[model samples]
Target: MSLRTLAVVGTGLIGTSVALAARRQGVTVYLSDRDESAARTAEDLGAGRAAPPPEPVDLAVVAVPPSLVAPVLAESQARRLALSYTDVASVKSRTEREILATAPDPTRYVGSHPMAGREWSGPRAARAELFRERTWVLTPTRLTSKRAFDRTLDLIALCGAVPRVMGARAHDEAVALTSHAPHLVASLMAARLRDGSAEAAHLAGQGLRDVTRIARGDSRLWSDILESNAAAVAEILTRLQEDLTGVLAALHDLASPGPAVPGGTGPGGGGVVPVPGRHALVDLLDRGIAGVGGLDGAGGGRRGAPGRPEAPAFPVAGGR
Candidate 1:
């Protein structure tokens, strides 16, 4: 059955976006937020009504930060706010564990994360088509009731997202590699530009802009995300550090002087010299090109590539 009604517990970007999308599909949405003004803003934007529903909703979406998901879901469940509950927080394992421990009816809850959003946040940044063609991960435990799972899938469908079911631990680890770690890497790279020379800043082009786009996100919220998924994020960052050390060493070698090339004219007619680590530099560049090419057109992984598994289709509720 289609989702007829939903109650969004936090009217931030994701929450408001969900409400807007559901409202577009003729679903009744009730918006609420701890910051009452935010909820009102969403209501004014035509996402939904700011007032509480007269009866329990079909689903309740807790679209808060990872740290708040458990408590908020528990409270909503205790109040009988909805027949089913789901959260749109990035990290899943910690929130799932907390829900199991604290929620009044853990069987009614499912964990979800929409692989969508802009760097800009708040209810004002929301749009009904924000989730179109995007991945919406559903992490359902063995204790999740079939009815609740199906209702969550109906919510995903209404939002125009493809659903993919995974275990909470697996989802956490996957996102840490793809999303969480990348955000930290982007922020660290962007941090270097803060004290850069004016000329350097002026010469910046789309490459730097693209890499640092997500660095403009809310730091407090990102801090909570990093903390919640620290272990998985740390593992990925450690591997990145190892790669960085090798690249730095290669760059140093490339900058060092080497034996002069016979009969070669250098700049200003001086004898030309070869740089050390030419082979290493070339290899690194080649690898970078290959890695980037792999990410293009096929999303992240290359399909049918040797030693790489084909990308899995987004799983629907009962079947795809």
Candidate 2:
């Protein structure tokens, strides 16, 4: 069935964007947020009306942070805000577990995470097109009703997002590797620039900018996300730490030369300093290239304007 009425439980970027996209699809949207000003901002921007739905809507998208998803969903369900419910929190496992324990009707709920966002947050940064061609993950449990799951797919369709279903734990682990850990790595690299010398800052180029771009995300929100997915993120970071240690050892070996290449090019062409662990450095670079190349067409799907629904290419089923 097509989604007709919708309630957005938060007016942040993801929530506002969902409201805007739904509105574009002719779905009535009611927007609400803890920050009244933010909800009004979304209303002023034509995302939706700034109020709770007078009666139950077709679907309610709970777009709160990871820690707040469970409580928000429970509260919304208590009010009977929508016939079905889904969330846009980045981490899914924790939220899913809590929802199962707290929600009045866990069968009416499906845990979801839209793989689309911007560094800038809130309604001001929201765009109707933010989810175009993006993957929206649905982590439905065995208890999830088919109606609830289908409404979420309708919501994703209305927002022009492709739906990919996975288990709650799998979704959390995947995002930890692809999104959460990468954001932390970027922030770590970006932080180094804070204490960098003026000369070093001046020499910074696109490579540094690209690596640090996501570091501009709201820290409070990111802290909540990282805390929710701590175990998965930690697992990835631990592997990264091991790699960093290996690289550091190789760098030290290269710096402490064991041999010298007799050449004619230093001052007036002297002997060249030998790089002892050049092979390790080259191997790392090659692996980096391969890893990046693997991303090309990793999630293939067709792009369309926001609100233009597309039929999913495959049958939708949640992972174990």
Best candidate according to TM-score: 2
Candidate 1 accuracy as TM-score: 0.87
Give each model's clash number: 0, 4
Q: Could you tell me the TM-score of candidate 2?
A: 0.89
List runs of model 1 lying over 4 Å from the truth: 257-276, 299-320
Q: Candidate 2: where are CA atoms >4 Å away?
A: 257-259, 262-275, 300-320
Residue clash pairs of candidate 2: 264-269, 265-269, 265-270, 266-269
Instruction: Show the lowest summed lDDT stretch of 10 residues, model 2.
Output: 311-320
TM-score of each candidate structure, all chains considered together: 0.87, 0.89
Q: Write the per-residue lDDT of candidate 1 for residues 128-216, one digit (tens) a residue.
A: 98888678999997789998899999999988888998899999998897789989999999999989999898999999998999999
CA lDDT of each candidate? 0.87, 0.88
